[model samples]
Target: MICCLSSLSTCVANLELKVKKNIIFRSGSNDLFKPIAGFSILLLTAWSMQILSIRFSQLLFIFFVLFALWPVARKAWRKSLEGNIFSMETLMSFASLGALMINAVHEAAVVLWLFHIGESLEHYATQRARAGVSSLMAIMPETVMLLDDGILRAVPVSQLKPGDEIEIAPGGRLPADAILQDSMAAFDESALTGESLPVEYAKGQQIYAGSVIVDRVCRFIVTSEQGCNAIDRILKLIDEADAHKSPTERFIDVFSRTYTPIIALLSMMVMIIPPFFYDQPWDMWFYRGLAVMLIGCPCALVISVPAAITSGLAAAARRGILIKGGAALEKLAEIKVIAMDKTGTLTEGRPTVVCVITDKPDDEDRVLSLAAGVEEGSSHPLAQAIIRQARKRFNDYPIAGNRQALSGQGVKGDIDGRDVNVMAPTFAPPFAPDSILQGETERLQDAGLTVVVVALENVPLGIIALQDTLRVDAKKTIQALTAMNVDSLMLTGDNPRAAAAIAGQLGMKYQAGLLPRHKVEAVYLQQIAAPTAMVGDGINDAPALRAADIGIAMSGGTDVALETADVALTHDRLAGLPELLHLARRTRTIIGQNVTISIGLKIIFLLTSMLGVTGLWVAILADSGATVVVTFNALRLLRTEKTLPQMILKENS
Candidate 1:
């Protein structure tokens, strides 16, 4: 009988403990739902207090306040156990409980209610700022039209593998990076490139994923495996951006660690010192101290930097400028000198005729027409340049007959029963230094041009000077950078004359004949003078790009350069460089504004609370309201300048 009684008592005690644990967890879960429920009960208690007896009504009010305080207190306790005893929740928990101890039940209820409201607003602002990143997710198509054994079938994008042929319909986005197989089509690449115009692609050209098929149905051979497409790469960058915090954000984080605990200790001193030493009323002094704790919550100060950085990153991505993280963005704004590669960075990577000097000025067009005719069948770079130049001036070119490749010299053929030759300047001149034709040819060569001559029956007609032409936006980009007080320098492996010609045209300095190692050394030397950025578009530039303060690459550049760069201009436009710098500067400005707003409000409320001029309502506002304001201020980056999608939407609307 004794053993049976002891076993029954142990079982009952275990059951009671289990019930208590269940009750505690149930009340603590889903903080928002319970607080809302508790608020409704508090409202009912306030109304019933008018009719009920004083003692019963007082009990009801106290019970309602405790019910609302449970979640806040539980969160504070959990944080304390994790060694974060001075968090914002801890301050709020103590403040509300202090109000309850002082018989300010209504004030306590209002403070918690206001805290919840402020939290909801902060949540909404964060979600809205993230809306731009969410829109990028929608750019990828969930289903793809797979070409299986020449039969079209809809399949999940995840099942796609390299070398699989797929067909995309008009208005459909590509599911993966692919090569155009059969038909040429126009695609809207705004999602990837941020250009509002539709780019036309030829057969065999590579098209990135997320581009919308604008004109017609097209077949493509997938080149990327699942989860390795362009959009996937972008999403991965965003996911990793947080790990690279800016210096400002790191300082704020470190500052908050010591700041929170100091505030907690100071609040304690405020509660005890005045009542004991100054002989003030204990109740009033304690109330003022609770108000001080509420005012000292670092919610606003802690969130200020990251909120701006997150919004700035999303904004930059929308503009087709991929900055690795806040660290890179912050570095970009500090750049005073931008060292840029000449070929493919400031100029087109291919040669084009810049000047046409004919033996007789009137015969320039005639000379070019004959040269284009003779070089029609040649696949040489110089031959293609002549043909491209001729097409720009004359629509119909005279046909050549019996074309012969003059090994190492150039091409020769008969145009309209007359023999014409397009050969290197070494073979087509009068051979006299003083002769007009010879002098002109040497002058063109001295200007870094590849001088090729067109001859009729071995008599020099004219020389066509060719070199890689400057990009259309090169001058505009340089001018914008100059206006912003940033200097530009050209770094290239090309000969001195070629580098000088390009640098002269743009009014910038040049360092020519550099190997990859020399370029890296140049970047290092420039960094000593001021923060410098290196922009390049070739595999040889990868080393220098990695060595700069910030490495920027054109997306159309070699894979090595793109991967090594800290920032990539996806549209491969120089104009985007200035825009990126502007964004960075704006982000820094907003961060400063946010910090000032957050800390300034706290200082005001802290002083007012200690003087007993403000109570819990103003104290909570100083903390939570400041958080909402700074968050919304940081969100301004999303719309500071119109993004590609915003521009497109505005046009349609």
Candidate 2:
């Protein structure tokens, strides 16, 4: 079992030298004192064994065991006082002292040393799991350049409030989430969104905290209050992630609480029952009993799931996939079907004016102007598209008066005292089957363009066709999901023709003309066959997002959508879906491997120790070594991208 063991005295001597040189342990002298002292005692015991009498070496070994047990004994006694008597430290203390009582002095020393090394490895793994949050905290600048009345002054980031303007020097991190005031700015958002290259944001775009200003100096108006920026939210989520434990992690917690005490009781029984009833030698059975206690520490078993879960969460966050917790990450891997909303999830949510047809060629401009007038203040995607088109041809559109939205239809208002209505073709009055308006509506729909009828005094004026382009990676993402044996389904309120057009292009299933509630129903239907995940990025998608087994939202989505979804692709790229899935599946695999390693080793050593095949030193070495192995195995999730080449996010088009 001791395949390789470093010399404890040599390791401690090197550590002491480093401390004296003020290298890594300069600030950790107090922490170094215990290990240095414990190992030095073992060194002295070794030297005494070389020349001194056996009795003298035995006495020195006893002193070493007692000195090693001092720190562990304090912790064990505290927990025993708290009614948790079978804690890891408690078990190890009893096991090492039992070994000494049986005159296994050398085994006792090695057992405690290995136990401490295992604890240190566990501590290091935990710190490494949380390194993401710590590294992110380091990115925020303590001070920012505040701009006031054309004067720039250095001010603490904490002192900056909402609406305060600040200037960012090139290569400096943004202190808080703010809106860019310059015409355009280039920033290195790799620390945040994980894009390798610098991203360009235009004026009025909201730039998150921790983004490095990569180009020229620029100014911004702080939009986030202190501690509510992008980094703060991510940190808070990671902190709360432990509360939302995965089923595997939760089960391990409950199992360990009962399993530890039962193992302790069995170890005591092994020590007493054999010698008292079976007439076994007291020394032999006592040594085997101590071996049982050491083998049953449960350190590796307890840490198996969480170590992997924590590493998985940190890895996902590094790639701009903000999974809320282990529960969400676990569910993500179980997703057999992913139902995506068409508007924002699959296609670019922005629609553009493809063409405007009118009764007369000259009336095309007039009809567009009327439509734009009513949609001027509207935030609807189609309404904005009309406004954008009108702006290109005319200086301004005549303002519509008494504008109103027709539920499930479109908008109606008065334009220059004439009743103007722009509504979906189906909602508009029936047109002559062979009429130009009807023909144009059918032609647009066939081409996957959303057609709206423009009316003046309830008479058809023209039809405008608008279309939202599919995301560059939409087809590729769907293909990737298909290759993984996960099906994709598109749910949209668009007409059957448009939905068919989009779904056909992506080669996926589709459900058209779905309202928010209908989308929820669709999610339910998908769940009948397998676990379903809903991916969307709009207010309408919130209902389905909540109803689905897992909800994933793009970061560019509405606040409600972002809040409703369990996971957020902060980079706003569909390509991240495959990467997220790969990470989740890999995490589940690593967790399984860790659990198998932990439990398998314990079971094997538990049998061997009971038959007196392995002594206390080998038992503790196996248990502590398994703990370190599982931890380092879990840490491998940090490099998952290397295991699966395609799991890395491709540069967004």
Candidate 3:
């Protein structure tokens, strides 16, 4: 801005001398309208005259029309006047008014028309760039089905009141925050809670809005209303997110503010003093000053950052990602390490069978079958894995049981008039698992699998090993990050066996058995190594995410992750991570380039003005043009290729 003002002042001074000395070439100073502006007004006038259309090209003329013909021209009245006028506006306003003062109707019309055209183009470009984030409204569902007793009721999600009982059926999204009361319910909480697994809802476990129920029906007691709900609060943060100023943006603003006053004073001297000393005509010098002011307009400077931001956001949108603002984008660019959550972030959040061991030959099939029968009737990942593995080997097998899922340990049922139990050792420390299954246990454990104990009639049957496998892309994604020189680390609430299994597979660092707060320590440590990003789509991931230099929330299950993350992946995708990094780097580049271009142009132009050779019109074009160019360049982010959907509806605000 400072450079812009300086350039404008010098241009104005030199232009005045040129205008005064060349009165014969064009005595009618108003005729110096921009070429396109003049032609457009001519075309408009011809059309208007033919059809008896309204033709008040001047604002002052519009004022007269309001006074004489239309009593209610609020839009016209307000549009003709507003807040601070930009440098381009100043030049356009002056050129048109000076023309009108000299009775050059066409010149005045062309100048104003030209400015309007430029402003319109700039606005459209900006809107197009910002289209991705502006489309967030479509991602949310409208209704949250509530249940009164066992009977179901459909209601607007926004109208859900605290304590209202809501039913989240399979494939339905939870409408509001609630205490989950349905014990058999399994929620794909990545959207709200950030836990990737189909989170098993105990009798009193809490659930939040925007979570999807993957399997089994669950009922919740609504605990929060619209503004207080999970997703809504995050959306509000996006709405109120403050734009953090980059060094370039702040400097430009300050420069622009100071440069205007300095240049205006210089232009005044050029117009008045030259004529007194050199016998130049007053009208000629005055018109030259006006032309100089027009050149010094700073439209480009105004448009630069917004345009860049628009493009950056658009690019992210095309890849199914979202960043709330320029500041967020900037922060995302700085992440050197990423602390990932274990349960839902790295793994699919579903446990799968990795080992099976039995003392007797038939025991393998028999024990797994009994376990599957009870597990099939339950929602825990361990139970689901037992069923999933059983079906892969033995199909068409009949299962009979009156099942009850034991929250802390396992599921139990009466099968064939006999009691059966499938238990995780962590849940039942007193139940000594069979030593016969020890061989397979070490193999699976060594491979990072969880050993589940199965029993028939209170006697040890066998062990079915389960593990949440790393995402298919997890290894490659880590490799990509490593290649980019970004350190990768994991924070998991799982035991050391589970953490080592996953981390070993990916050749990355891991810390196991971390509680919610302990994960914060991991995030803090990574930040100490370098600027870090805590990447996880989990409710547990939120605090660490907030503490990190950047937070990235995977899109899919829990929105809590999104609320805290600097960047949100609208689509659950690991590929988007790399793409976002690419965009951040690109956005930074464009900002830097624009800043350099704006300053460089101003400096060169200012130098010319000091030599009394620069003109106002040139300064205006250069300043505004730089801004526009920067914006368009930034917008280039919308075209990046590469979108890989890993799948999740997790969130961050």
Candidate 4:
């Protein structure tokens, strides 16, 4: 549609140009080639846009090249295209061709040249914004391990079927939805779950695609096809939402549709108005109207907004932020509240023991040792911390006995022929420690630690302190948000104690013990005050993401959250939000500037066209020039802003 109509307009310009070239000899000796120049560009634009076979498109391209072969026509077109009114490529085309049709050759050429320059700038900006997501889609692995009859073999993932058992090695990516068949498996789900920790999988536990098996080799029974994996689902979300456009794009579309007709109508009035008021030649009025129409190309107004949005996307892509498109970037800029998850967002999601409480003689060390001994062969996070504590205390640790874990309590084992147990405080409190130790337990809990008691052979020894480690940049990020006058709130599924501890540390308001639905409700509540952005990594955070005004999912967040989110950061960085918002707001500003500049120039120039003070050449230049200026202005975003925070290191508070 765009191609066919554009060519028709080109014909109109050429008809006017031809009339002028013959009538006016003083404009230039080189003014004879206007029609060919306008004809070639319009023809190519039309042909390329028409839906056709590759062969036909190529054939049309051949004809375009034939224009180059006819050097004489090319020279005439080039000379005739150079009109004073040219803005961009369109300016040159309009000035030369429209002027020639209206008996003014120089103006049409300038418009044509200006249009091309704008197009070129807009294309560069679009490429940059599309870089990140395209790069991610490129990393999809093509092959996988196929298991059959207990024998493992390499095969294309597509060849595998459900019930096939694939042996996954440490550090290998999970290729399909499957259930773990191994005794123990540890998975790094950062890419899929956004949790910055390796999740331990037991037999019968479900595993998902895009999750890397970090340690302990395991076998999984494939239950789904390769394309139906979690990662694929996330990509599909971006595809489904592809129709979304930036605010700027919407405005430009509205303006482009109406601007040309309005200008054409006014130009006609310009011609008629002159003859009614004074004695003028019909040729003079007609030529002036043609000049007004020649300068009527809305190239700048049509392309300016998209150029700004594309430039913003491109700039975000360079910063390790994968904003899906111009629309997402624009939405992010309007975010006034950022509701962040306590675990994995503001804090490292990993839980660690940062404190210890001793109530009896060597209480802390003894309890840690017994807990570690019982958990020596376990894979749970708390167990691992105890084991590390044991190693740190003893330096060279003795071999532990066979161990077993009691679900939701603790692990158990034999230590030097003594049966030892390490369980929760409510399970085996005061087994070894005196009653005086009770105060220490309260102290640790009050200080924001989950206390797990370790008892050796039924004797309470000491208490273990476990807390989520926070991200180093969390405080600064919150501070930055505050400075921006945007509220920052921490929301979590964790217990009130843990949530309070984190919120206090960050100095932000907190909402604790929230289910996925509740998170959504909280966002809906915040929305009453202002636009909100919700960021999180867990599947539990998905509903809230969709409910928020703008949902930002960490680059490494769970597949569900990532797919549900409107904006995604590829670097897994929280700090990028501030910059992303900054960029989006600036993009809107640039678009507004482009629109104002384009329309302002036209209004002033349109008057000149009516008075015959500006020829068709200058009119074309003004029209196309606006497009190039806007494109250049939008691209300017790429050179600004540097450095975003890293996602890894430390644990959730």
Give each model a TM-score. 0.80, 0.86, 0.68, 0.68
State the weakest 10-residue window (summed lDDT) of model 2.
644-653
The 10-residue segment with the lowest total lDDT in model 4? 644-653
lDDT, candidate 2, 528-555, per-residue tens: 9999999999999999999999999988
User: How many clashing residue pairs, candidate 4?
Assistant: 68
Model 4, which residues run further than 4 Å from truth? 1-98, 121-243, 276-279, 360-365, 376-379, 391-408, 411-419, 431-436, 642-653
Q: For model 3, give the RMSD to the true fold.
A: 11.8
Residue 313 of model 1: what lDDT? 84
Q: Write the per-residue lDDT of candidate 1 for residues 1-653, one digit (tens) a residue.
A: 34643553464455335433543233233432443444565557554765856665666567555655666777789999999888888889888888988998767877876776666556556666656665777768888889898799999999999999999889999989899986579999887666788988888888988999999989999998788887777778877886799999999988998998898888999899999999999999899999999989888888889889888888888778888988998888899999999999998786898878865689989999999999997888778888989988998989799999988788899988999988887666364344477777778777877788888987778888889889877877787788788999999998888899889888899999999999999999999999999999999999999999999999879999989999988767787887888889889999999999999998999999999999987898778889988999999998855634234334433
Tens digit per residue, CA lDDT, model 3, 130-164:
55444434556788677777778887877878878
lDDT of 1: 0.82
Q: Which one is best on lDDT? A: 2
Indicate the residue-level lDDT of 327 in model 4.
73
| Sort by TM-score, top down from the best | 2, 1, 4, 3
